[model samples]
Target: MKASEIRELKDEEIVHEVRRLRRELYTLRSQAVTEKLENPRQFGVIRKDIARLLTEQTARRNQAKTAGAAE
Candidate 1:
């Protein structure tokens, strides 16, 4: 998924997506070990998507913290 698409998801939805992606990544890894992976590039794509979601999650948390501190 694109960063903009990821940014549009709610925090909970983002978390869900991350979990789903992790599972997919795990499956891909297992397939790779068996040399059954059809697309080796998928690993990088999923990893990037997971990172993007986590980054967004962290940014939201930091924004919340700063906002609370400003009050």
Candidate 2:
């Protein structure tokens, strides 16, 4: 998913996406170990996506903290 698309999601939705991605990553890794994975690059892609989601979540939290402090 694009960053813009991720940014449009609510915090709860973003968390859900994170969980879903983690599960997918686990499955992909298992497939790779079993020699059933056709494309190893999928693991890298999923890892990056998870990182992006995490970064966005952290940014949101920091923004909220700053906003609260300002208030």
Candidate 3:
């Protein structure tokens, strides 16, 4: 998914997506170990997606914290 598309998702949605992606990643890794993966590059793509999601999550958390502190 594109970062812009991900950014448009709500926090809860983002969390759900992250969980789903992680599970997929695990399955992909397992496949890679047991057999040759058709698309070996998927691992890197998924990893980057996870990182992007986490980065967005962290940014939102920090923004919330700062806003709360200000209030």
Candidate 4:
């Protein structure tokens, strides 16, 4: 998923997407270990997507914290 698309998602939606991606990643890893994956590059793509979602979430959390602290 594109970072721009992810960033446009609501916070709750982003959390749900992260959970879904992690589950998919686990399934992909198991498939890779037991058999040949159709697309091994998917692993890297999922990982980066997860990272981007997490990064955006963290940034939002930190921004909230800083805003609260400033109040």
Candidate 5:
């Protein structure tokens, strides 16, 4: 998923999306080990997307914390 698409999601949706991506990564790894994965590159893409989502979430949280502290 693109970062723009991820940004469009609400916080709750992003949380769910992260969980779903992790599950997909797990499943892809299992398939790869079994020599059944049709597209192993999907694993790399999913991992990157998860990282992007987590980074965005963390930045948002930190921003909120800083704003709260300044109030």
Candidate 6:
């Protein structure tokens, strides 16, 4: 997933997407163990996506917290 796409997602959607990606990562790991993986690079790509989502999620949460505190 691209950073621009991630930025466009709602907060709830970000959480949902992260959960879905985690499941995919788990399955990919299982496939790798069984030597069934077609593209090993997918693992890195998914991990990066997960990180990006988490980063955005955290930033939003922090922004909200500061906004609430300032009010």
Which parts of model 6 have CA positions greater than 4 angstroms off? none
| lDDT agreement of model 2 with the native | 0.91
Cα misplacement distance, residue 71 of candidate 2 (Å): 0.9
lDDT winner, 1 or 6: 6
Q: Write the per-residue lDDT of candidate 1 for residues 1-71, one digit (tens) a residue.
A: 99899889999999999999999999998988987778889999999999999999999999999999999
Q: What lDDT, from 0 to 1, does candidate 4 have?
A: 0.96
Relative to the true structure, candidate 4 reaches a TM of 0.94
Model 6 weakest 10-residue run by lDDT:
30-39
TM-score of each: 0.94, 0.93, 0.94, 0.94, 0.92, 0.95
The weakest ten consecutive residues by lDDT in model 1 span 31-40
Give model 1's TM-score versus the native structure: 0.94
| Model 5 lDDT, full chain set | 0.91
In model 1, residue pairs whose N, Cα or C atoms come closer than 3 Å (at least 3 residues apart or on different chains), thus clashing, are none
Per-residue lDDT tens digits of candidate 3, residues 1-71?
A: 88898889999999999999999999998998899999999999999999999999999999999999999
Clashing residue pairs in candidate 3 (N, C-alpha, C atoms within 3 angstroms):
none
Give one digit per residue, the lDDT tens place, for model 4 in 1-71. 89889889999999999999999999999998999999999999999999999999999999999999999
Clashes of each: 0, 0, 0, 0, 0, 0
Candidate 3, overall lDDT? 0.94
Q: Pairs clashing in candidate 4?
A: none
Q: What local lDDT does model 4 show for residue 25?
A: 100
Predicted structure 5, TM vs. truth: 0.92
Cα lDDT listed for each candidate: 0.94, 0.91, 0.94, 0.96, 0.91, 0.95
